[model samples]
Structure formats: structure tokens, C-alpha cells
Target: MKLSELGEIGFLKKIEASLPLSDKSVLLGIGDDAAAVRVSRGKTLLSTTDLLTEGIHFDLKYISFYQLGAKALLVNISDIAAMGGIPRYALIVIAVPDNIKVAELNELYRGIKKTASSYKVSIIGGDTSGSKNSLTINITLLGEAKQGNIVSRGGARPGDKIFVTGTLGDSSAGLELLKKGKRSGYLIQRHLLPAPRVKEGVFLSKNRLAASMIDVSDGLATDLNHICEQSKVGAIIYEDKIPLSKELKKAKLKKSPLNYALSGGEDYELLFTVKASYIKKVYNAISKGRLSATMIGEITEMKKGMLIVDGKGQKMPLLPTGFNHFR
Candidate 1:
């Protein structure tokens, strides 16, 4: 059935069916203005907000409202994770049109609650208002880290090694698949539900392995450029060293996956740097059986700018080409 026919409540019921609540601190889930939680001492608070609009951030034709709600919260949690913090609470504000049904609103909240519970975060409070045409969701996540343990985007030193959590370009590849009307399983899932590396981020921060970190909500090239700009350093990413999903490889063989991986946005993985001394320690903390951390790059002097070495060993200038609000 078309989304318009489902109204809003009908859509919400569908989403509510899929949620599994495991957290005990969530006094109210999917039915309240906010979520509540308890926290311990010696922790500094971390907060971040992400705003998503109907046409600007997503297309209703391809994305489901349930997924939209989950993604909205997930992206903000990713920002908190980028700072090496544990998400504890969220405040969600939604602006909806008159055509929206009460059920659809419930479904969206279901998505938010499900994601928040998974991260063990509570939804605290927010505001709901009427809008003209677009459905807008603004999520503010509250997280915590030990005192002075928060990682930032500006701490990468000259000799630090650049590392990334999880594979890159999958989201972009997934978007390409949707645009092409292809139904590849991997790409579709990647696009619909990109997991934020919160556990890994907390581990890195607790162990004091990461010098600085940022999530690749934007493309790697653009996000890494952000690190460079903030840290006053340059970086060198090895082209062949970039990790690609099998789905991405297939897409590349058929088209240009590198361009999408490098310039496309919404990867949700953490891009972090560690001092040369902590490289092994950080790797040891994040390494799983197969998904090992690869040394894809290094921080360089500010005068060098960002560079990418092609497989043929040629140095090429790196341009910051990713999602921009005003571009």
C-alpha cells in the first residue's frame, strides 16, 4: 500500500510491531515527549543535534517513516559516539503537516524509542508542532564520558595514524542502488539501517587510545578534511587501503564506487586518529576476528594539504567533495 493510504497511525502500528524494548530506565517509550535515565558520577556530558527534513534529508518514495525515525536518532548518537561518549538521553522535536495521522507520529516515535533503547539511552523531552508541507525531525542526544576523556575533531597530531571504524562507502552504494531501482540485499540494508559504532567509540575513549575522532556522516574525504581543518594538519589516505564492503566492490565493478565512497555521505562509521605509540593498543581494542583496523593514512604537516595515493602510486590532490547544505 502507498504511504498516503496508510495515513499515520497505520504506519506507526507497523513500526511498533518491530521494536524490542530491553532497557529498564525507559519509563515511557514511543508514547511520551521524552525519555528518562540515570547516570553515574565522574562523567562529562556530551550533546549533539541533527535535523532531518522530508525532501532535504530523505525522499519518502524510497525511505519508510519507521526507518526515518530510527536514522534520525542514530545519526545524533553517532555524533556523541564520535566524541567517545555513551549516549544516555534524547530530546526529539517533530514538525508535522495537517495531513499526517496520529498513527504515523506514533510509528516515528517507535523508531526513535527502539534505537534509543538499543543504545541504552532514554528519551527525555521535546516539542511537537504543526508545519505546512514538510515533516521535520530534530533530535538532541545527551551522552557522557569520563572527565577530560572526551575526544574531539581537533586533536590529531603530526605523527598520529588515521584509522576508521567499519567499512566505508556502503551507504553511498546503498543510495546508488535505490536510485537505480536495484534490490541488492546488502546495499538496501546498508542504506536503510546504518549502525553507529558506539561501543567501539566508548572502548577507544575509555582506553585512551584515540587522539581525536569524528564520524563519517559525510563522505570520508569530506569528513577527514574536517579533521584536517580542525586539527591544523594534513592527511594521506591510501586508495588501496580503504575498506569497501563486498556490495560496494560489486557496485564498483559495474560503476564508480570510489567516487561514491569518497564523496558520498551517510557512512556513520567513526574516523579516528591515534598517536603512533598507541596504534597497536587501539587496534587491539577494536579488532574483531575479521574486521581488523587498517592503517589507511597518517597525519601530515599543515603545509602539505590532504593527499590520496592511487594504487599506481601517484600522489593526487584531495578535494573536499561531500554533502554540503549550501552547495
Candidate 2:
């Protein structure tokens, strides 16, 4: 049935009934004017929000409402993960177009519920409104971290080693493959379902392994530049050190997969830095299979500028080519 037939209040009732509302940290959940949540003592609250619009952030032709819903929440979770916090509460707001069926929106919420359950997050509240043209989804996520454990992009220092979790460029490669009418591949799954590195972030923060960190949503170069700018430092990543998945390496494409790794966005992996003294600990973790990370380069002085060194030891300025909403 159409949303118009159910009316806004009826639709909201459905949502309230379908989603779990018994989280211990939540004093009040759906059906309230505002959500009430509890934060443990000595914890810092982390909040982040992201907006996804049809035809801009995603294409319905290639993705389902369920996938889109899950992805919408995951992206926001990634922001919290970058800060090394634990996600706990969510506020979802969506603008539904008239052409969308009520069942479809239910599927969307189902996806959100499933993802939230996996992370032990509670969907406390949200707003629904009618859209004139496109479907727009926005999620506000709240997380918590020990007062002394929150990591930021501004903590990087000169000489700190840079590292990233998981292979890069797969999401963009998956996207490109989808654009070419290819389907049912690892690359495509990477694009459709990005796994946020929440546990990795927590591990790094608890162990004091990362000096600075950011998620690879906007490509390596652009996101690294963010860390550089925030920390008042520069960086130099090796061309050969950027990790690429086997699928991405074998995929035939017009541009180099290296380009995708360096410039393509939405990888959702963690890009972090560690002090030289902590390198041994990081390697130890890796050797013991506790962490999946690779040292790509080292932070440099701001005067040195951001650069990428080739396999032949040639240096070149690193440019930011990641997705920009207003670019």
C-alpha cells in the first residue's frame, strides 16, 4: 500500500512496532518528542550525521532500498569508528517520495534495524517527511569513548608511521564495475555493503596504537590530507605500499587500480598514524593476527608537503581527487 493510504501517524506506528525499543541505555525511544539516553561516567560522547540523496549519493537502479538503508547508517558509523568510539544510539530521518511503496520503506527500516542490532545500537527516534522528487536519508549517530581514549585526526605528528586497515580501491572499483553493467563480484559487494571498522578502531584506541585516525570515505589522498591539515603536518605514502585486494588487482579498467586506491572514495577503511615507538607494538599485533593493518608511509613536516613516492623512488605531489559534494 502507498504511504498516502497509511498516513504519517499510521506509518510511524508501524515503525515503532517493528523496531526494538528496550535498550538499557535508552530511557525513551520511538513515540517520544525526543530520545533520552544515558552515558556512563568518564565517557565522552561522539556524534556524527550523514545525508544521502537519490541520484547524488546513490542510484536506486543499482541498489535496493534495504541496502541503501543499511549503507546510510554504516557511513555514519564509520565516522564514529574513525574517532575510536562505540556507537550506541541513532536518529534516522528520511524524505520519502510519492512513488515509493510502504513495503519498500519497511525494508529500508529492516535493514537499518539489522545493522543497528549487529553493533548494539538503539534506534531511538527520527522524523519522516514527504519529498517532492527524490528519496533522502539522513542518520545521526551517537557514540561514546573513554575520556582519554578518543582519537582524532589532529593527533598525528611528524615521523609517525601511517597505516590503513583492509585493502583500498575496492569500493570505487565495485562502483565502476556496476556502472559497466557488471554484477555479482566481490568488488560490487564491497560497493553495496561496506563494513565499518568499529572493532579495529576500538582496539587501536584502547591499545593507544594510533596517534591520529580517519576513515577512508574520501579516498586515501584526500582523507590523509585531512589528517595532515588537522595535525599541522605532511605525509608521504609509497605507491607500492597501498594495499589492493586480489579482485581489484585483476579487474580490467580504463584507469590504473592504483589511481582508484589513491583517488577513488568510499573505501570505509581506517587510515591511521602511529608514533615510531609504537611501531613494534603495531607489528606485533599484526604478526599475532590481532590487527589487519599495513604501514604505508610516514608523516612529514608541513614544509615538506604531501607526496607519493613511486617504486623507482621518484617523488610527486599528492592531489586530492575524492568525491566532493560541491566540487
Instruction: Estimate the TM-score of every prediction.
Output: 0.84, 0.88
Candidate 2 has its poorest 10 consecutive residues by lDDT at 27-36
Model 2 C-alpha lDDT versus the unseen true structure: 0.88
Could you tell me the TM-score of candidate 2?
A: 0.88
Taking the tens digit of each residue's C-alpha lDDT, what string does model 1 give over 1-327? 777777544565578668856876332233211222324455465667788999888987778778889999989888878878888888999999999888887888888889988889898899999999999999988877775677778889898999887788888778777877865578778877889888888788888888888888779998898788778999998999888887787764345777877887798888989998987776665565422456789999999999999999999999988876633
Local lDDT at 272 for model 1: 88
Error of 2 at 140 (Å): 0.2
* Each candidate structure's count of clashing pairs: 10, 0
| Number of the top TM-score candidate | 2
Highest-lDDT candidate: 2
Our model 2 lands, by Cα RMSD against the true structure, at: 10.2
Please list the C-alpha lDDT of all candidates, in the order they appear.
0.79, 0.88
**Stretches of candidate 2 above 4 Å error?**
1-41
